[model samples]
Target: MKRLTIAPDERRHIERLVDDVLAEHGHWDPVQFVTQAKTVAESLPLRVRQFFRQIQSEESDVAVLSGLPLSPDLDATPTGWDMAQKTGAGRREEVVLALCSAALGEPFAWGNQQDGRIVHDVCPTPGMERSETSGSSTAPLSLHTEDAFHQCRCDYVALFCLRNPERVGTTVVRADRLDLPAPLSGILAEKRFRHRPDQSHVGPHGHSADVADLDAIMFGPPGSCYLRIDFDDTFAADEDDHAARDAIKELYRHMCDAVERVVLEPGDAIFLDNYRVVHGRDPFEPRYDGKDRWLKRVNLIRDIRRVFLSTGVRSRVIS
Candidate 1:
């Protein structure tokens, strides 16, 4: 993981930039701001710009920027993403993330998730404590590649910490760190796995029919490979292919063995390379006293054209 700490002066510069953004746009509409964000991001502090440039150039597995400016009068953690959206809580933080994320790649969203909001609120909800989505508090979110089912899944998953009284840990497993046997690696390289859209993407219309595409669990070169698998949603393409099933089980074991934990503090934002890292969260009890763990998340793709071509429209939100 690569890390950078923003100096006091840099933080102040960022705050000014954020203020200018909020002042110009009255409402926090990232969809409208995205095209402008890239231009705005060019004005970020030199060190900060260099940091993100290094991350992109090196394809860093996990990178973090610390000491970002948080709002002094920040609102309480919303009960869920819906509550945050309704109240527009943490709007400034959303701009902070969007601007910083723009330094790396183009931000995008899913129409089926969080009402197509470019930046999503990740906080525990009352009844969804045990669910598989980000709202879950009690269940240990299984480490998986973000949006593993989608062809245009983000190249990076940026998460900004707002509040975390419990100091919950964000778990990660790096693909480059795994050292599997040649036999197992060979099996995973084959196209024997199917990735299904996670819980967050399934809307009232139900799961998309095209999610059953067969793909390899690991891809790219031999030593440094990219991963795409969800423990809950990915399965062997052929039920009768016991070898494929066994390979997935073996890969899961390797993933568990290679797990690493990162505890993010307020004002710290972590950008996980979706292709190189699988991330999850450790289970923690939610107090629901408006002080529960809260985070802002955004998905970034290397190029916006992929989304435009996929949707057959020049929009960031994928329907």
Candidate 2:
């Protein structure tokens, strides 16, 4: 894991950058802002820009940037993402995330998730407490690769914490931390596993027949493996494939043993390399009294052409 805390001067400099963008734009339009974000990010503090550059070149598994600016009069947490969206809560922070995310990669969105918003609101929503989506509070989100079912899945999942009064921890497991035996690793390297879209993409009652894809659990150069698996939705392609099923179970056990928890405070943003780290959240009781944990999430890819090639369009949103 790698982390860089913003210095006092750097924080104020970032505040000025965000203010300038907001003053020029009347309203928050991430779709429009995304195109210019990378160019604007060049104006960020030199130290901050260098930090992100190093992470990109080194392929850091998990990285966190702390002490970004937050509104002094930030609004109370909304009941759900829809409420946050309708109220335009935390617009400034969203801009902050966009600027910083653009430094790392091109920010994108999923058409079927979070209403196709480039930035997504993650908070506890009533009636979804035990569900599998980001709205869940009591149910612990299982550690998994973000958008594992898609070939064009993001390269990084950027999560900026706006409020976490309870200090709920985000669980993470790095691919390098697992100590799998050769037999299990060999099985995982084969293309015998099927990944289904998570509930966030396909609602609780929605079917996964349309988005299931078969791929390897682990792939890449020897001694350095990349991982892609959603424990809750991934399964063996053939129900009779007992070896693949057992390999999945064994991998889960290894991940459980190597799990690490990161508790993010306000003004902190974490970028999880989607291929090298699987991340989830710890279950917490929701107060819903305008103080529930809230975060802004953005999916980023190393290049924008990946999205264009996959969607056959030049837009950032994958439809």
Q: Local distance difference test, per candidate?
A: 0.94, 0.92
Give per-residue lDDT, candidate 2, residue 95.
97
TM-score of 1: 0.98
TM-scores across all candidates? Answer: 0.98, 0.97
lDDT of 1 by residue, 138-164 (tens): 999998999898898999999999998
Residue runs of model 2 more than 4 Å from their true location after superposition: 203-212
What is candidate 2's lDDT per residue for 40-114, written digit by digit as tens? 999999988998999998889999999999999998898888887899999999999999999999999888787
Counting clashing residue pairs in each candidate, in order, gives 0, 0
lDDT of 2: 0.92
